[model samples]
Target: MDLKLSERYEDYREAVRVFLEEHRSVWRQPMADSDGRPSAAGRSWQALLIEHGYTCRTIPKQYGGHGGKADILESFIAAEEFHRVGAPTGLANQGISMFVPTLLECGTPEQKERWIRPTISGEIVWCQGYSEPGAGSDLANLQTRAVEDGEDFVVNGQKIWTSSAHFSDMMFVLVRTEPEAPKHHGISYLILSMDTPGIEVRPLKTMTGRAEFNEVFFTDVRLPKTQIVGERGAGWQVANTTLKHERGMLGDPGQANAMLGRVVAIMEEETLDGVRLIEHSGLQDRLLRLQARAQAMKLHGLRLLTHGLKGEDAGVARLIVKLNGTILNHEIAAFAIDVLGELGALYEDSPHLKDRGFWQTTHMFSLGLIIGGGTSQIQKNIISERGLGMPREPKPASKGA
Candidate 1:
């Protein structure tokens, strides 16, 4: 079997390398140019990439995207190059990845024209409104209400664990529109301006001392009738599409490999018992194992890409990669913790800390990976029931407590 990229892709890869090489130093310490970027340099650098078509390669050209179709390998290569340089890969991503495709698949022409370009250009930002305090993993049980009132839906409920909600200018949300109907059947999807009155966003800070998530509460916030993404009661299906994209976005084998590379670099530089860490047999063994796993993930991703190009079902690969990516990342982080030893305990502003306290930060972040997008438990359910066609255990309804 041919393991290498086709000649066309290889040429594209070389072009990608040379273009990314020119910005290596700038990317190393870019200023945030957009609201997402804390400095203007980072924003400017990303804008340059977008201008040169080094990012958003998967997005279609009609939505101010690139290269027409979703080119998986090209998209992978673009992200790999950026992550390899330790650059902030967050460009105009909500639109570029999740929303744009969802819109293309499900939105009206008007909605597409109104939202896609601005979002891709970073003119507007979007946040998802799926999980509520009452309904996270069991999202069908959400109680957030959106009452159809004449031409508007008056929304009143709260969403928890909402990433970038505070920074978002708009939200694509799921709300219970039919109170008496069954849980999943009653849900509806809507897009609304964040500036709408009676909406509130409060930051949720993580252990890393970063407020990357928000708790957004709505008190009769109103959106126009035209804002609904699909049929009112069909939101359960629409929301599922949005979520499938969310879970798929979690696959980034390049990021995983880059992390492993960082760990290897540390081993090469650090010494243990006056002997170089590179010479330690146990550490070397563990590192080699992680390297192997990362390699498997990369190859699996390539296999998935090939299948996708042939219009074949790669859902099994998708399911496996998500679980593999999370586990491999957690293991890498855990090993880094050991390497750091006492330095792992140091966080924030500590000069004695290794890698500027990143080891501790990544270790904490790894735990979230197991939960983010979809939990590891949920992925196992998917793998068993859908991938392997396992019989689901018979369950009785819960008795009232």
Candidate 2:
């Protein structure tokens, strides 16, 4: 594939750089909340990004986006420029990153008009309600029920590992709408307000000292039947769309490369026993291996984009991104901690902690991502059956059989 950019793209890159420089101070300010919700200033910055065509560039202006024509190269250039300067590309949340794309693909025109604007603009926050006590990896086994009651579906059951559910305004959920149908066939996708009666959110605290994940319980929650995204019993397909976007969002190349840059910076600047870590032959080999892997992932991302533009199937290349990207990010953060040596043990709030304990935080959070969107084992199964033309994994026999 050609790596060289045309003159127009070159100008686009320069414009992105100038935009970042002009708004660097404003973007640099910390958000009031750290658990993925954007603050007022952060939302303003996101709006600025939309206005300047730096983010949501392909989504239509009617939905509060840039409404530009599809240009993967330009999008990539903007991302590169933002990461190059350590500026946030835009506000990425469950609402903007995952749900908006799904809604654009499967939602009715009225649904888009009602939700997309506030969702992308950070005026509305959304949480996913897919995983449950029994349905995490084997999501078809979900037992959450939403029975029809006149114009509404009375929902009851629970969803665990729901990130930001406690603070979200809405949810895109899956439920067993047709109990007599086959497991996958019985599911339906529905959207509902989080503030509805009979809904409860209990936050789950992680080892990182954050209560971002939650267990959400719905007790006879009434949602209008009109809130269903696709036809009843077609949620599995619609959810696949959301899952694809979720994986892409979780396995962000820009964030991975940025974290690698931070690791490299730490290695060059920090000394171990009076010798720089980068100068050590053993450490140099490790860093080189990581840099090589990072470059490969970047090239793979470009190849995926190329396939997308050409209307070609990406095969396993697309499926491998989330698994490999998450592992690579975790390994890179682990390498930074190793480089930090004793200082790595120090958590945030310590005056002597390096990079304000950012690497340590990443190390923990990255591990959760490996399990969040889908586990590494689950991803391998998908690559094998879906990408490699292999036979599907055999299901376990029944108890009496």
**Local accuracy of candidate 2 as per-residue lDDT tens digits, 1-401:** 58888899899998988888898888988643665577888888989989988778778998888998766667777777777777877776777877888889999999999999999888888998989999989999999999999999999999999988977899999999999999989999999999999999999999788886999999999989999998899999888786555333323465666677778788889887899888999879988898889888887887887777676778788888878988998999888888888899999798789877888899899899888878999998988889888999788887893
Task: Record all residue pairs in model 1 with backbone atoms less than 3 Å apart, i.e. clashing.
Answer: 30-42, 31-39, 31-40, 31-41, 31-42, 32-39, 32-40, 32-41, 32-42, 33-43
Best by lDDT: 2
Runs off by more than 4 Å, candidate 2: 31-36, 243-257, 399-401
Alpha-carbon RMSD, candidate 1: 3.0
lDDT of 1 by residue, 29-103 (tens): 744444553345555565667666666555566666654445666767666666666566646445456777688
What are the models' TM-scores? 0.89, 0.91
| TM match of model 2 to true structure | 0.91
- Kindly report which residue stretches of model 1 are placed more than 4 angstroms away from their true locations once superposed: 22-53, 58-62, 87-92, 243-250, 398-401
The 10-residue segment of model 2 with minimum total lDDT is: 243-252
Question: How high is the lDDT of residue 198 in model 2?
Answer: 97
